[model samples]
Target chain A: MTENEINHIFQTWLKQHKALLFKIVRSYAFNEEDRDDLFQEIAIQVWRSVTSFKQQSAVTTWLYRVALNTAIKWTTKERKHQDRHESIDVSQHIIESHQPPDDRLAWLYEEIAQLNEVDRSLTLLLLDGFSYKEMSKILGISESNVGVKINRIKKHLTTKSEKS
Target chain B: MEFKEMKKIWDTQNDEALYVINEDALHRRIKAKKMGTKRKTSFSEVILIVSNLCAGGVVIISHLLKNSGNVAALSMGAMMMIVGAYILFMRSQRIKRDQQTDVSILGDLENAIENINYRIKLSQSMIWFCLIVIAFTMYTVLNSDKSLLNIILISGFFIIGFFMSRWEHKRFNLGKKKQLLDLKEKLINEFEM
Candidate 1:
């Protein structure tokens, strides 16, 4: 496809699923600067990779995969630096933001934040109503594993909620 | 809470309030890619100037040695080669240094600031090395007499460069520490509120 045509297609797709980018960024970023940086970086990566975008899968699936990978890599690097600088407690940040008082949402974010990076991505995708197949594609995990993991996460959440 | 319960909250939450995509801003950023390219080109120009000066000095010394059989010319040529090699090595290292990635959201600002510090060091080192070479050439031009003056000046530059680099390194570390503390405080306050 021509460059202009490709750009148009990307722009259209970006308009539709741009919120997904924000969701991922918000889940991972610490502040406004980080959010803006991640958003720009994701946009650049998406634009760069648009040429290689095959039509075998949906555009949203591709976007989630790219966005999650970028966010995870970003967070891992930041965490290393934070560990060195000041022994700032990440749990404080996790707990303090948007408490939701009696709502289950805060608990959900806390649990998801506590999960390993890969599992966190999977859980977020599942929570967003992605099918097991779509989750597998975004996560590079098998569909069966996605199903197994979601069930396990569901059970874990239930147990945690009971304790609380 | 069960995944279903959490998902319900996630679904009902005001996503519109949380996420905003300014396409025009994004488009402007993409268009500004050329500015980054321009900065890189300017950096390359500095490298080119140093390399060309070193190369030119070598050619001149080589020609003088061939015609006059002067030991001084040969020594100058050798010195030029050393400077050329040093410049090339530094340029390659600077390029490698620029290629690092900071993917994390919280630490991205710190990493970027550090990268800028690294670039400043590279540039300062390049300038100092070039000045040292020029000082040596001046010493040679004066028939190698009063070599102590050249040595003192070179040492002074080296000392200054060392102190500058140390200061930059300390400042970078402090900035990183401050950023982490700020983020921690913000997060804490956010939780409290």
Candidate 2:
């Protein structure tokens, strides 16, 4: 496909599923700058990979896989040189406040950020309404494993929220 | 709450906070792919120059020492072998680092570090091997006289390169270890909070 055609498809995907990309980036980035960097990196990667995008899976599934993978890598890389920046406090970005979190949905996101990397990806895919088969394809896991993990994540989130 | 109720809440959650990409800017960036092209071109140029210098130097030294018989040939062969090995090792390391950067998953960090450590060891060994080769070359050039001055120079360079590489490897390992520790701490704090 031509670059223009790829750009058109990407624009449509971005408009429809931008929130998913944003949330994944936010969860993985240490700060706003890191989020923006990851956003650009993911966009570049998606653009590069779009030519090979077969319609075997939904666009949302492909996008989530790319975005999550990008964020995870970004976090891992950043963690190495993070000590150099003594002034940039990570705690500032942690969502902890008493403003009711703008509703339980915001609180849900705050909690999602607390999950481990694999669990966070699984939970985010579940929230995005991916079927077990789709989750399996995106995560390279078995459908049965997806079902088991999702059930465990649900219980874990409940206990976590109740304690809070 | 049960899974069903949790799903219900998740279904009803607002997702307006998600930021979508600006397609126009992205298109512009795609159109301006010159930077990547330039980087590749410059990288290839450097590799070409270094390879030429290494090969040319080996050829000239081999020819000059031609009258010295098999020992000179062996020294020349060993030098070329060292250079070829260094080039191959560096190329492999570059490819590995690129691949590591392309994929982003937490589980890959350890593998990346292991690759880095392997590269460091290869580099250290390369330095020592080159030093030994240089010492042999000097001894051959001096007709096995083993000049003290040449030995000092060869040993000095070897010691310096050895210590420098050793320091670099230590620093890299320390940095990687600290990063893993920080990641562990972050995960704990996030879950605990």
Interface DockQ per candidate:
0.14, 0.13
Query: RMSD to native for every prediction?
Result: 12.0, 10.0
- lDDT string, candidate 2, A72-134, tens digits: 666678453323322333323222112223456666778888877878888888877789999
For model 2, residues B121-181, the per-residue Cα lDDT tens digits are 5545655654565566555546755678977786677668667756765675456566656
Q: Label model 1 with its docking quality class.
A: incorrect
Clashes of each: 3, 1
Name the Cα RMSD for model 1: 12.0
Q: Residue A150 lDDT in model 2?
A: 85
Model 1 residue runs over 4 Å out of place are A78-103, B13-18, B23-41, B68-193
TM-score of chain A of 2: 0.81
Per-residue lDDT of candidate 1, residues A47-85 (tens digit): 656778888887878888888877766665534232222
- Report the Cα lDDT for residue A5, model 1: 71
